[model samples]
Target: MEIRHNELIQMYPIGYVHNIFKEAIFDEKMYSSVSHIVLKEEFQDGLKDITDFSKIYVLFYFDRSEGYNLIQKRRYDGKIAGVFASRSPRRPNSIGLTLVELLEVKGNMLTVRGLDAIDGTPVLDIKPFIENDMAGDDLRSA
Candidate 1:
């Protein structure tokens, strides 16, 4: 499948992320920090029954990522690797996916831990994280 030259896809943000950290930093500090995913009033109904899950998968757009590099050196190890092999925000599409611990769900708002998205980041969608979503240890050796 291919998109035409003029073809375009559109997406609307259901909510924006709110967190204390302003800058995007790849570190272990986000593990304990809390973040709020405040959704629009119209989308509040979608949160029904979401609190039952312990974790959720958040799909968001990298609104702050400026450009892309197919081959770039990783920040931590300074090792050159393909863009697809690394989790660098600078990607072709600038999309981000992360599994976060769901602390609680309030009307139109979801309080979560371990969200790396910056404040005001657009949230595309959210889904409950299931065990099947992860691969087994045996598969890692394949």
Candidate 2:
């Protein structure tokens, strides 16, 4: 498939995140915090059977992030790495993927633990985290 570098793509948020965090904070507290993913009324029905999974992948948008650096020092370990290699919010697409623990599901709201996104953050999608689906070290060969 030929990729179009200038192509413009658009997406709508399926839900919004609710948490105590008002902005991005790089710390252990942010990753160990609890948050809620509230889906729109129209998308509420899609949560059926989702409770079967203990963990989920939350795809969100970094609405506040402006620009990105190609190479920078990592937050935790001062090791320098490329944008793709580091979990930086500032990126070309500003898309974030976090694997959070699913705590409870009530109505259109999902209580999750360890979501780094701040309150009112737009959620693009959510998917179950399957252990068998993890590529892990196998991805190095691919």
Best candidate, TM-score: 2
Record all residue pairs in model 1 with backbone atoms less than 3 Å apart, i.e. clashing. Answer: none
Clashes of 2: 0
How well does each candidate superpose onto the true structure, as a TM-score?
Answer: 0.85, 0.90
lDDT of 2 by residue, 46-119 (tens): 99999989999999999999999999887768799999889899998999999999999999999999999999
- Whole-model Cα lDDT of every candidate shown, in order: 0.89, 0.91
Write candidate 1's Cα lDDT for 84-105 as tens digits: 8887999988889999999999
The segments of candidate 2 whose C-alpha lies over 4 angstroms from its true place after superposition are 135-142
Give the lowest summed-lDDT range of ten residues in model 1: 133-142
What is the lDDT, from 0 to 100, of the residue 60 in candidate 1? 97
